[model samples]
Target chain A: MSTLTSPDVGRRTTGRRGAVARVLAAPLVVAVLGLVTLLWLQSIELDSIEKRTLNTDYLVDRVREHLLLSLSAAALVALLAIPAGVLIHRTNSRVLRGVVLALANIGQATPAVGVVILLAIVWRTGFTTALVALVAYSFLPVLRNTLTGLAEVDPATREAARGMGMTRTQVLRRIELPLASPVILAGLRTSLVFAVGVATIATFINAGGLGDMIVNGLKLQRYPVLIVGAALVAGIAILIDWVAGLVEEYARPRGL
Target chain B: MPKPTTIIFPSMDVRGAASGGSATSGGGVSIELDSVTKTYPGQDVSAVEDFSMRIEPGELVMFVGPSGCGKTTTMKMVNRIIEPTSGSIRIDGQDVLSLSPDQLRRHIGYVIQQIGLFPHMTIADNIATVPRLLGWSKKETSARVEELLDTVQLDPAVFADRYPRQLSGGQQQRAGVARALAADPPVMLMDEPFGATDPITREKLQAEFLRLQADIGKTIIFVTHDFDEAVRLGDRIAVLSERSQIEQFDTPAAILAAPANDYVASFIGSGAALKRLSLMPVTSADLSFGAPASGGKRPQLDPTATLRDALDLLVVTGAEALEIVDADGTRLGCLTHAAISAALTQSSPTRGAGPAAGEGVHR
Candidate 1:
């Protein structure tokens, strides 16, 4: 009897070790890619146009601008969409929930570049338009996650909390939220990564970012600049996702 | 297995000597529902209509019926989980509707079939929910958590820090009960608290719950669709029909011996005689000190064992009689099928004689 169960224990130990390796693998791969890009750029001689965009100062500024746009938009979505999702969930109104969810669906369904360009066309081109467009594009995942996370709490668990004399608010704060955190965090992680990708479109409206390098390289036919810009953005996306993954792991309630 | 020979024996008078009593630990209070009725809006039929009953202090009354019988609705009203459309529910003579629903619930223990231990919280935190709600000190709450885990037979050191998912179904159920009893409330409302477990686990849980109730003696309203569960665990089984109508409310032995109507009899189902044997101890029968049969050793039963257990042992061993032993394993007497039958027949008169007759034998 004991021997029959021993393999399960061995498998479980190996599975845990595999999970640790998986967690570390993303950053390791991104680091190597970043190093390779740096080495390739160092080896290649750049023309005047490529040199202009490929310098450390310009590259850093574009990366800074890119980070500012994506991070702010993700932050804004987190602040607004989550509470709104919660409020809609608490109201428990079918019509209200349905309407909000439908609007969220439309917001997400619209292409990211289309949203950014449409907003810039309608309301002057600049950083603000890109921010709003990014927020709009990424809003649905966090909002939908919050609503679904709250909705999917076990009814029996909800009832048990209420049955134990917890007020509705107490139930949400003490029981529902903690149980829903994993799914909610997953949604936030998705939106953050999405914001980084969508922020690339910011360069179209003269909003400064790595996108500028890619666009300038493409228009001027400097493949080195384009490669550098595209490589940097991809690296940023992966790194941001890795950091978010760490936060998610640390913040998740134990025993879930 | 040999087909045992049948033995005839004279009937013995064991009426008024059955096992039913309301000895309490003084932690429970009386609950009264006067003309309680609940009608959900837009639904013409009432879920529970004009339901009224008086539950004595420390009594475990079971509301037993088929599904959709409104039994659960009736119990939920006591804690105001589902407020009554029109009725006065009093706990220890205080009107429950007057108190804030949350405050009212804090004082009433509640458990359900789902065994809803919070998945994210440790067992200690789950058990401490009510205590924290009532503003108990952390030290006091932790101590109480430790005590309750021990009470439910879960080792406090081992289980207190474990999450709900880490526990087996039976352990989770124990945690659910421990969580409910955390604040030491005077009244408990249970809705099929053991219904979700497998049969063997359910039986073990039932026995543990019975032992727990005896020590704490909180006036409990336990609801279940399983009639055998009702008979085994209830101090008084309230057979409910549709609309939460009380068909009969009396001791399990009384209900088993004498069902008030066909509805209750139907709820009792078949083999009630065998069910009644469960309520009676082996000592209730007039055990003979006759010599054992010419064979190897026969199966032995404890004196505290029930007549049903005695019957089971006899059938399993295929013996005409079994020896009843004391704590030291010394044979007290021989228990036979005839003695078990006599005990059942003697207790059968209280049947159909109504709740009063049942209560007499029960007390």
Candidate 2:
């Protein structure tokens, strides 16, 4: 049964405190905190570290590259996963659904670096191979969630729509998708975090990302760069997860 | 089951001479089913078999049977939710099988026991579904939605934006009905539409629905396993045995006066006579215009109150008779205990058919 009442949904309380609370609740707070921490680290760093790690241009390029890699991979996975999940769910043949689900499972079960290495061998090393690897590694969560979300819609609701003369495609588009969006968005969040974390391995395939800094720092004994690189990756992952959380909240069915 | 001769029962309110109501349009299209049967892919026994009946436009006919007797299956077959393996279904002389299932359903309203309003949609959106499908103008759809919400006794301003989860079960059921009626379809199929609510709410909704039907006059096929509900609401009830075989199809009063078989008699339970009393309203009993009560606390009953209520009131008030009044409290006539008896005898079993012939009147 739906517990979502209209008054409680999408109502923005007005006041200074409410404004403060809204800002405090936003995911951008993590981004702000991460920036502050990074500045604090730079303030206390040694001269050698300041020359390399404190160069704003250099740091910005790496952060931009890392984001580009993760976001693109997430986009690719979503582009592929959602339709595949919907198709699998709509298929009448149990065998076909089972086979497609098994394929998705294999994609997730494979090790992240192993997938990258195999893709690198097949397609040659670069951003393309790393992207393909990242997409493969993050595929299951969105696909599985989509299937489960669509399947969980109440059968009686579907029957009522059909009885009322909604065509099959209309039922899916109007009823099933709206009802299942929250679950699907949660799955997207999971895939996004995975993509952010795994994009670090792309540096091994000569794809420039924050992984480049971390790997170089470890090799050259630049502890400041190493800590900053690792810290930045973790920060990005937290930031992306927070945004996805916002989207999921927005997607939740009203009165549920 | 033996094939009984076809019997045509008049609409419950045909005596009212309701000429303006479209339901009384004797020349309108009627729904007719002939030897309809449904069998599962692997099951040897058919789910419903040889179901034959004709329902007049604007009349409400109920199908009552035990669980798994295929009452629901028969209802679904009309909307093409469940296809029949053999037989023909026609609505107003048009073959149902020739139309696309979706198109056929768009012209029909449907309600189910679960009252499956979409959880994600606001009440207004839910009610506007069929209208939107029919491609009505936005302004027209909203106006129709507001009108229907009022018709169902819900405030459009308050409930229009509220989700299904915000309303009580009874309220949700009303919204379900509103949604079904949105397109103003000519035919409706209801499967235990009020079966999920509590008994008190069920009665209230039933009364309200009857009042609504009196106004709109659409052709309705209602399915329920509750015999009492069937008797209360159906203009005519179709009692089915296993495999959707019609045992008896007659008016509620007729069925209570004389159940066609032991199967239907057992369904009516032990109080057939009292059930008949429920069918006869206080207005049906002959009332005397005795001199206006000179007095202290004269018991008053509504003319629309049932004879059963009148009888019960007589026992409780310890009065020789009760005054019957209209909605405005204008004194209409006086109803006596003897008047209730007169109504009962007027519908005695001697005028009908029954298994236990000697038990028609205890007194």
Candidate 3:
């Protein structure tokens, strides 16, 4: 009987593992193709023209800044939204959930450049302002997913918890969180990808991240530089998504 | 049930053992409901109405009838989960309505058919809910959790770290019981805790619960719609009719032997004789090793066996004298055909009240 059980558990793990693997596989191929194309393009930069040439060091720094921009914001949202998400779900307080959810959606919909511009006017234009704008832009996906995942949990399971004498908080902490984790993680990945893509536009403002390379390359008509910067940003988004997939896969409830 | 030919006499191994076992920690409290009524405002009829009964503390009593007989509604009133519109339920000579709902719940361990364990908490954490609510310290709560798991026959080490979803349905139910017992409350209310399982699992849980009750001695008011379960586990079964009508409340033997009215009789359904044997234990007085056949070459059996079990032995082993031994293996008595018959017919040769065997029988 015990042996009969581990296989069922194994099959579940494999199923989720397969999903993460498939998602990662596509991004891995994309990164490799982008890498080879960049290598070939760098070999043929024509002339000492007063044009923006691809500076490897600048490119690396911009990539680092965008990475920082997306990861820090996504992490913050995940931590805050998961608990709030489950609380709303267990209470089924649609009114409260709807309010916060609308705020998050508004945050996402309020154009990224506008947010950066507004934040720059209010605060000093720097990495910190850039971080705030990125986080705000990324909020809706994570918050919405957390709410939807938690709400989707089976009510029979919740009824079971109440009947067992679990307090309201205990039910959320123990039962609801574990069950809703996968869906919430999926949402987190979506938000991270969005933040990475949107962070490129923040360079239009003085909140200089790697978006500077793309914006500078565009103005100077430096085609190679622009292509490399855009390619790097795309690669970063895919990488963050792959990493999120790994974390989520590892953390999905064992029997899920 | 069609009445069985078996009439096994109840053993005098210890006559007053079962009844006197219900003293509990304090003096017994008789639970009463006087004209209690509950209507959910817009609902057509009241869920429960004018329901009343007397339940002694430490008693293993069950409320049973058809679905929505208001047995559940009535049980919920005791803990104030479902408030009664008008009635009085006194615990230890004090009116229960005088206390707050949370206060009342802290004193009552509640279990339902769905064993709602919190999946985030470990088994130990789930078991510690009520004690911590009652302001117990960390050490005290931890110790109590371990003790409760043991009481419910779950190995603390094997179970403590696991979440509820990881457990089988039966295991979850055991954990639910452990959680309910956390505060050592005098009253435990169960709403068909075993009803969700298959018959085999349900029987196993019921047997284990009965053995646990024997040890803990809590006053349990169990609500189930299953008549067989009511007869097997209840010290007294209270039969309710549609809309909270109290048809009868008496010992299982009395309820089966003499139902209070036609409603009670219909609720009793079929197969009374074999069920009666389930209540009687085979005693040394009733054991006859060499009755009507050879006493050897049969599968060995317990002399303290219920007539229901002995019938199976008689069929398979084909031996008259199955060894009647205690767990220590001392022969108590020979289980003869006569005793099995006596137990079923509601005929007690020695003592105690019987409905058909005496004048006080319900007419």
Go through the candidates in order and give each one's C-alpha lDDT.
Answer: 0.83, 0.81, 0.70
Best by TM-score: 1
| lDDT tens digits by residue: candidate 1, B29-123 | 78999999999999999999999999998899999999999999999999988989998998888888988888778778899999888887788
Against the native chain B, each candidate's TM-score is: 0.87, 0.84, 0.82
Candidate 1's C-alpha runs over 4 A off are: A1-17, B1-26, B286-302, B313-338, B350-363
Q: Model 3, A97-139: lDDT tens per residue? A: 8898888877777888899888888787877888777777777
2 against 3, candidate with superior lDDT: 2
> Each candidate's fnat, in order?
0.64, 0.63, 0.16
Per-residue accuracy of model 2 over B1-363 as CA lDDT, tens digit each: 121111112222331221223322332247999999999999999999888999987788999999999999999999899999999998877778988887778777899999889988888888888767766656767777888899899998889888888799999999999999876666889999999999999999998998888778788999999999987888888999899999988877778887777998999999887788777777777887475567645689987778888888889989888888899979888888887888787756542444222221211
All candidates' TM-scores?
0.89, 0.86, 0.74
From the highest lDDT down, the ranking of the candidates is: 1, 2, 3
Predicted complexes: DockQ each:
0.38, 0.43, 0.16
Candidates 2 and 3: which is better by TM-score?
2
Look at candidate 3 and tell me the lDDT of residue A239: 77
Question: How does residue B142 of candidate 1 score in lDDT?
Answer: 75
Residue-pair clashes per candidate, as listed? 2, 2, 26
Q: Which stretches of candidate 2 lie over 4 Å from their true place?
A: A1-54, A251-256, B1-28, B282-303, B318-342, B349-363
Displacement of the residue A23 alpha carbon in candidate 2, Å: 5.2
The candidate with the higher DockQ, 1 or 3, is 1
